[model samples]
Target: MKNVLTYACMILMLTSSFMVNAQLPSKEKQYLLDFNKSTHGEQWQNKWNLQEDPSTWYGVEIKDGHVTALKLYRNNLKGSIPDGISILSELKTLNLAFNTIDGELPEDIFLLATLTSLKLEMNKLKGSLPQDYSKMTNLEELSMFNNLLQGEIPNGIGDISNLKTLNLSSNYLEGSLPKSIEKLHKLERLELFGNKLAGAIEVDLGRLVNLKELILSYNQFQGDLPSSMATLSNLEFVQLQGNDFRSLNSLLRLQSSKLAVFDSDDEFLNMKFGANEANRTRLVDTKYEDTKRN
Candidate 1:
């Protein structure tokens, strides 16, 4: 006909350029073999790889080909922890904390919404503490201290809101400590020491107005102390030691008393019960002496 329509237009333009060159380098080697089978290919420091194996592993970061940072910290990694690491959806950063890896903690890592920093803390991981962690709203820093985690601490974690440092200290967690954490207003450091949190000692935590440091030492919190905590005033450090005090004009009516070191193993038993029943025993700083001495 016309040389068979110009050889069928050069065989359909070389079969559409060989199917776009077999799909852009096979989707960049399947994104570096799905990040080298999710780090099971162990590696320490291998600065940005194209295919540079020091003895195999962690070295395959390609830009216009996908797969970003995947740092392997304190690499003495044991076994377990492989699920193609959420297929590395252009991951921002994922540090596999000081290793000795046990189990749990792989629910697709909350789908890395441009994850900030998630150090999995000294591992031996148990369960409960991952409702997609409230969808990781660009989380700041969430270190999982001494793992073996139990339950309760996930009331959608006050929806992140760019959370600061929330270290869940010494785990085995129990209940009651979630009044929406008084809505973490750009919280500073709130370390819950030695777990088993009991109730009442709340004042909506004075609405956390840029709080400094407030450690709930040895959990088992008893009641009263919420005279709006003397208006927070960028409060300094205040550790209510041990627990179950219930006196000392209830800690000087918490007009905060210039607290830089308000440690109460029972500060002289709250000053001998606010000077021997100041109000003839209305009991435990009654409304902070009826709203600061009526």
Candidate 2:
């Protein structure tokens, strides 16, 4: 009887040890470890103790023995993101904003099919956005503002059907706004302010029925505003200042009762409003000199 009891106690100890140590799959854990080492994890604000279980690591979320999220925003991560990040196949969110992470984005990152939100804003990242977004269909919010990215917005961006907020503001991105952007029927905020993007607003703006804020200030965009813009009933804020637009007459037919702010160059038209109009909406017809970021 004494021998049997001792053996039972040993079995319980081993079971508990396995439960504690076998939290993550070996491959995923190794990928995480590699990421940590490459990013100088030791210098992070909340450094991870490599000796401990990965479940206890900072900004890492594990579920069903798979890495599901990694949010290390403003944590002092100072290195370029390592390759093989797509190995975290179950990852849904990857937030590395406000870091010193530089270099062209790893090509593998666009392969994260399950990623819903990817926030890499306020970093030193440079290079053009990927041309193929077919694999990233599940992305809802792709915020990469305040970076050094250049080149035209990819036409393949329309492949992200689930996208809601597309903020690429405060970058060095140039060229005309892609017509494919009109396909984002779910997009709410389309901020492209403080860039060098030129050409007329050719796309049917009315197609984006859910859009609320359309900020295109401080760009090189010229020509008349698209007439379809008058049909955007959901628009609340519109900034078209600091451009070479030929006329603002197209906006006279705007039907949005929710239009709270409308800013444009006053030289194009003498926009006068009644006291009642002034109380309902704030219209600023002046040149915007400073870079506005949101």
Candidate 3:
């Protein structure tokens, strides 16, 4: 009789384990649930509500109960993001640009550890930003330009050491850029144009070893650029027009190798230094007349 009771107990335990495993949703499905609170997201809540007819959703891709991607570009979405959208443990991409969504972005979004791309631009978002922004360490692309965002840019953002492309232009953000940015050693493209930012653009910006496009035009920056050792030896071009650049005479001819354009303006454009040379004179012309391009 003791043997019989032991066997029954083992069977019960095995059955319980199986049930728990079956109930756990796959990593992808959790992602679908994470960003489903946005305007069009509501239509994707129930799989049965969607599986029967897939076209109703602006865009959604799921496999094995996991959401792999979501694209709602130019959808005219409205309303606040629901906290539940943070459950997308396997979600990789999210694009909800060109809409009228208002209010602060949900802080819980930082819980998405696997997210790589995020585009929330051209909206009405406003807030200080969530502390968990560092949790998105795997992020490769981030764009939130043309929004009503405000307050300090999160300093811990440098914790995302693998970031490649970043665009935070056209916002109400103010304050000095975090010194931590020098740690994004793998960044390729960075754009922070059109904001109310002040203070010296961090001189360490030249440390991004792989950076190609560095556009920081249209702001209140003051002071000459630091002559620190540069990390962007491979830089394709740099745009520094429409600011309070103090010393252009020193920077215009620093590298005979010639940056696509180490641009500066007429007030400080030293014609005498390179006035006799054709290429050198062209830099002055480009610096002034070509300011619109960079």
Which is superior by lDDT, 1 or 2?
2
lDDT value, residue 228 of candidate 3: 43
- The candidates, ranked best first by TM-score, are 2, 3, 1
- Give lDDT tens digits, candidate 2, residues 34-86: 88888889899989998988878989888766889998888899878888898
Each model's C-alpha lDDT?
0.60, 0.83, 0.64
209 Cα displacement, candidate 1 (Å): 1.5
- What's the TM-score of each model vs. the native? 0.30, 0.84, 0.72
Can you write out model 3's per-residue Cα lDDT over 1-294, one digit (the tens) per residue?
Answer: 999999999999877755543444654344344445455554332322435322234466554445556676666577766666666666788777776778888777777888998888778888866655667888988888888888867778888878998888788888877788788888987777777777875647657878876667777777766554243466555556677767544454443333544443543443422322344333211321212110
Candidate 1 residue-wise lDDT, 1-294, digit = tens: 999999999999877655543434454455455544444444533333546322233533334334455556656555546554656566556666666666677777766676766776667777878654566777766767667888988777777767766767667877877777678788775667667777775547778776665666677777765666556666555556676645424444455433344445664734533423233232111211212100
- In order, what is each prediction's RMSD in angstroms? 16.8, 6.2, 10.2
**Which parts of model 3 have CA positions greater than 4 angstroms off?**
1-56, 229-231, 248-250, 253-263, 266-294
lDDT of 3: 0.64
Error of model 2, residue 177, in angstroms:
0.5
Error of 3 at 150 (Å): 0.6
Q: What is the lDDT of candidate 1?
A: 0.60
For candidate 2, the 10 contiguous residues with the lowest summed lDDT are: 285-294
